[model samples]
Target: MFEYISSLWSQFLSLLSSFNISSALDVLLVSFIIFSGIKLIRETRAEQLVKGIILLLGIWIVANIFSMNMMKTILSYFFNFSVIALLIIFQPEIRRALEQMGRNNFGKKLGLLNKEEEKQKEKKQRCISAVVDSAAYLQERKTGALMVIERETKLGDIINTGTVVDAIPSQQLICNIFFNKAPLHDGAMVIRDGMVYAAGCILPLTKSNKVSLELGTRHRAAIGMSENSDAVIVIVSEETGQISMALNGVLTRNYTRETLQNALEEYLSSSSEPKTQKKIPSFRKAKKS
Candidate 1:
């Protein structure tokens, strides 16, 4: 045992002596790429698929170690064509990652704000106020509502799924759209560039098991939409009158009128105006799904 340990130590020291700056840089780059790929698949269905693939790989290794010819052959054939299979299974995740890479954040990075940009900021501020007011009204009456505010990623495809109503947002208009008796109340409303771009739009449902089962279709849809794009989704419960927001696959709840406005402004505004770092309370209670 001591001789074996000495041999392993000698090999380790030899490996360390051979390592250089280029090897260090190569290792770092590979590590960063792996980390980025994992982060890209983190909260989506792809995460589970990845785990399944890793398990299969481990089993294949074990089969090889045991010289199980039949098992090794089957696993080898599966892995031989795994590249194409993986592409088909991960198509949505790949598309979303590419879109995120190409998303237009250059202006924000360069801090460029022209006259038209300033006007757009004003419009978004007004829209935020109207949305908060309508959410407050709906929460009081226990009327369910789902409003999606588009950000860097364009939601043109999603907007096409619903009836277009390109009008400036207003508290009364928003409330009427989500009224229980209204025709569009059952679907989602898409707010684009400070205007009500569409209503009655259908959103993809979340497939993640991480979400609480108590959440309803609206909350799941909100989380799903957030997972697919860089949008902020506001939801008001029909039964409990609780307000919630879904962003980047995380749902935060218990937002009052003032805090809701503050949160929206912090997310949507591009102005240089300083704002308070008010902490919006998180999801405090279990919700129905």
Candidate 2:
């Protein structure tokens, strides 16, 4: 038994010796792609699909080792055919992932160059302040409002869906638009670069059944928008006068004025956003869980 262990160790050392820096980088690249794909589909219907595939693979491995020839053949054929089926089944998810990739800055900061970063930071702070103040005012009046603040992802598609306001963001403007009797009260308002860029925009509704039935259209739309883009969505409950923010498919509730302000600042700021974006590792996912 000791000799057998010694032989195994020798083979492991040989394998390690055969690997170079290029092999290490190759593994890292593959790992990053897998991680990014999982992150794109996290908390969506596609996550369940991935989980099912993992279970099937586990069963196939067991069946193959047990000499279950019929089961192995069936499983092999299923996997081979499922490639096309998965593409069809997950078409929406695939499109969304590709769209998100196109939206990213190619792992490079195009808009956030270090030279002008300080100026941009000040602007981002002002934007966060305006949004938080407006949200607080809306929350106080129970004036139902849904606002999407664009971050790294360009929301040109979403912006074109609404009436272009192109006015500076202000507490009064936000409160007035969300008033029950206002013209655009039924739709969402979008803020970009500290400006009320658009209003009366339509956002997609979340298809996941995991959301609570108690959450209304505003919250559903917020979640849906967050799922589609890397935007921070603020929602004020008309019925309960509660404030909530949705990001990356997660809905957080019961935010006070100060807490909400801090959250927006932390999330909207260039530095804080990177912490959330670095989900390319299992350790980070485990930490979040």
Task: List runs of model 2 lying over 4 Å from the truth.
Answer: 1-19, 31-43, 51-82, 92-119, 272-289
Q: Give the per-residue lDDT of model 1 (tens digit) for 1-289.
A: 9999999999999999999999999999999989988887775678889999999999999999999899999999999999999999999888777766776556676877789988998899899999999999999999999999998788888888899999989999999999999998899999998999999999998777777877899999998898788788999998899999887666878888887887788777742212331111124432333
Best by lDDT: 1
Candidate 2 per-residue lDDT over residues 148-225, each given as its tens digit: 998867888888888999887777788888889988888889888778889999998878787787889988898888
lDDT of 1 at 19: 100
Best by TM-score: 1
lDDT for predicted candidate 2 compared with the true structure:
0.80
Assess each prediction's global lDDT (C-alpha) against the native. Answer: 0.85, 0.80
In candidate 1 the C-alpha lDDT for residue 10 amounts to 100
Judge candidate 1 against the unseen true structure and give its global Cα lDDT, from 0 to 1. 0.85
